[model samples]
Target: MRNFLTAIFSKDKSPFVNAKAATSWCKRLQEIDMQSQHLKIHAAVTAFVSEERPTTLDSLSALLLIDDAAQPSYEAVCYQYIANPRMSKEIESRLWKQITSFAVDMAGVYQLFVQSETESGKKAEFALLMPKVLARSLHYLSIQAKWHYFRFEKVPSKLWTLSHQLYRLSEIEGCDSNPFPLYTSHAQEVTSCADEYIQMLMLGSLSNNNLSVRQIDWVDQWLNQWSKLIQMSRKFQEGRYHLCVNLQAPEGVQKIQAESEGEPFRYWGLHDLMHELEETLRRLENGATPRDLGMGKECPAPLAVELLKHLDIFWLMSIRNSVVQRSERKKVAKIADIISGLDSIIGHVRFDNDKNVRKASADGRGQVDYDEIMDMRLYGFVSTRTKEKPPPNKVVENKQKDWHVWNIENESVGGYGAVVHLSENEWVRPGLLVANRLGRQENWHLGVIRRLNRLGDDEVYVGIQSLALSPIAVSLYMEKEERKEQISLAEDSTLGVADLPNIRTALYLPHQIEGKNVNTLILHSADYGTDKIYRVQARERVFMVRLGSVIEKGVDWVWVTVFVISQE
Candidate 1:
């Protein structure tokens, strides 16, 4: 009946699972055999072997033997069979009786460890499972080959034994599969199943807070291998693609199983494995342990930084064979932006001097550049461009008419016919012509702030280089919510408006009053033939301003000006 029950419950639960179910099923059978304690005990023994139940010396002492003398018999049966070289079906069955009794006697051990605060109890619990683990392992290996010294019988010891082995491997070996079939599908799968079962058992045991020696041994052996098995399984499956694609597909179950076993440890490659192993060993020897960090909290900023590190690995493995989704791509792009912003904040440090930027504009990758930022304390006026009206709607005005407009030139008879102003409407359709400013052409003679000071209650004194009208606007990026603060800076005063023209650049001049700090200088312009100069200051402030004109053939010159202000 026990054999029949074992066969029914011990089948593969899934492709990725192994047969560790027999252990739990046998325990359930014990409850059903209430009338026959011997039967219950026999069932326990069978369950123990199949489930790799621990067979420690202390565990056998607590079994409810028919008589006190039978207790010694139980111990003798367990230790002798486990340590004995001889084997027979009858002898194995008798051995199963003692082993199961021992497991049942040791039940609730995990609960004791979980609940008890005493270190001695915990250590004792850990130590108790060693013998059972050794015996079970031997039984499992023997049954795995479907033989017991050239004889075969209904031995379910293989299942629990596999779980125990898997748990141990995971704990010791980083649990990654190591190009061995047993490590991946066979052994690892059993380990996974056993882990689930063991966790359930441990939970139950913890509630009791008192487990017999056998149970303690069982829990320890099972826990030891559980994590490693999981790691091994994942690594093996992940790297399987590389093996299959690069080498060849595994032919049969045995071969596939064998390959899965050792593939994970090998997946890291020899050099990486060596380094990782060395590091791990160093930690172990030094008694230093890795911190147990929670997943989300432990992750780095700019998720892309983490992803980028594994891009090469994913590409080469071709493991998943799936394209990244558009949403995922967008997320990655956002992460990339965050990463770049962080890099900028930290101030970029380059390993080698960039020579490309020095060579040509097209080659700007490697270059060392610096910009000095100063807080020029100034309080100047701010203004906006006047909005233009719709074109004249009268049809009579559109008709062709004899028109003679005078070419008027108001020239300063002596001090150079320099500064000129056109009506805003006329400036709208402005043309580019070579006009002289100082010693340079109007297009090339970019403006710069010499000084800006409050002239009167409604006007601000300003000095600029360009001989044309200066047009300017504040060009600082402020927090989205800080617009109120920015507007309040005008203090309800009628701020001065400037028609600063060709104002490609503006600098906040340092105040002669030594202690006053100059704050802001704004520049305004339409797209000129100039390159935009993006600037980042020490105070995490950033601004983009047009510097001068570009002499390219297809590029059009744009009109721009500058405005100045200060927070003093």
Candidate 2:
């Protein structure tokens, strides 16, 4: 029964999913309460798997598309869903339980398969079952690693016990099918990623927090298991790369064969796996700690910074594959891309830099930005991003987000200027996040404020560079509604409009602002309780901005949603 359940969820189409009716039945089973109906479904799955199943290629047509909502919905409900996930609470503990159950179940099943190998009668029967059991077990381990490491939602226990058990079973000469070093390597990689993530969070959140025994154990185990996996899995590639693709598929290699018909998908290739592992580790290096995104407040709040800090991972993926539909993910990807293109500073012009820009332009790749040269006075400030450790080359000192006020002396399309008063200890460096003055939200539309020139002893002129814009809108408040302030982008002000939700209409775009196009929100105010979606027709692509963490009652402009919405 246990093995059959694995088969049903596994990448391959087993007899458990033989026909349209069977697939429909599987979908129905997902909707039913997993706790109440698991036993019956287990029995049905068991019965189907015991029979001789079809191996026809035609069955491939039944697999779900990448975007099919039902597929993720089913997976979410049965294997990894929460009834109601509060940002304040850790995602459904059932996912943790299910993960634990699979690890335990697979260990027992491996033992049973090995013991049953003795009886020739059983060996013939177990052949088909063993391959899938090995495959599905590996498949879910990747998922576990993703949620635990990539999402930083939960901490994961080491997979050493289960991998070791399978390793011993594989050593048995005729154990039907052999499990490869895939388990061993993955066990180490997944565990290491999780440990590093925890350690990083503790460090980032470490103003007054002490390292607990649990954190120590996590770090210690990661150190212990990483060595063991290297020894057990054998040093095939050595230090060249953590993962690689196979030119011709080898029998000993662990691969998800079904998803590709004749090929594998899940952490199968060396290149993809290496990229996956590196990407996860990089998140720990540069992103919000588990403490930042986790449900528990005991962990510590994320280093106060832009959403961009938590979004470094998205920048690693190709642009097309980059964006996810979720509001936060979409917002992060868009902002990350937006900031990436803003790497232009008047200082530090490598000769080859213009060559690269010209090549990129000839490729017809980026947006054609026209430079507007202007001079003006504006108020701005500089704040450093929170770091996990003191920067190596940087002078040893405070790493917190230190706010220092500046006087903006000039402006341009690419960047703006300001005279900064830095203490003797401080230096105006390149690639720092500058809070370009946008009303009360000082850090709104952040740009890199860098050293342009020296005016005198205490004043250092700095430039803020980016292709950024902000629109002024009246903020409406609704308790429990996610976006506290919705920017109504209409030409006519909310004068005597019948639906007068908020009487105060004193909203103004920053003085001296130009080149921002606006549109009208259909309803003057968002509906009584729920959030309202406004259809805006922008002459050009206009964005509705949301600043990360400012929810207060005021007339001053603040972004309710940081990610942009296309006016078109």
Task: Please report the candidate that would top TM-score against the real structure.
Answer: 2
**In model 1, which runs have C-alpha deviations exceeding 4 angstroms?**
1-40, 43-223, 226-253, 257-568
Summarize candidate 2's per-residue lDDT along 1-568 as a digit string, tens digits: 9998887787554423445645565566556664534444434433433453432322212211111212333344433342233423354465555544443443333344444454434555555445434444433443343334322233333442333333334334333233332332234333332223222222222111112223332333333222222222222332322222122332121212222222221121133322433443446447646344321233332322221222221122112121211121111111111111112211111111222221224466852111100001111321122112122222232223333445555555555666555453143444343333433212235454333344444445555554234322233233223232233323346643334344222121232214533222111211211233322212111234322222111111221222234322
What is the C-alpha lDDT profile of model 1 across 1-568, one tens digit per residue? 9999999999643211212333333344445433344344444444444564343333332221222212334445544554444668688676664455444433323222222313334435533333333233322332222222112122244333343443343344332222222221133334332233233222221211122223333333333333232221325443332221101221101112243445332221222322343443345335543232111222232332222222222222122222111111111110001001111211211101111112223454422211111221121322111012122222221222122121222222111111212221121111111212221111111222222223222223222222222111222333332445445644545552222122233222222124543232322223232443433222222444333432111112222332232221
Clashes of 1: 50
What C-alpha lDDT do the candidate models reach, one value each?
Answer: 0.28, 0.32
In the order shown, the candidates' Cα RMSDs to the true structure are 30.6, 22.1
- Report lDDT (Cα) of residue 559, candidate 1: 28
Estimate TM-scores for all models: 0.17, 0.27
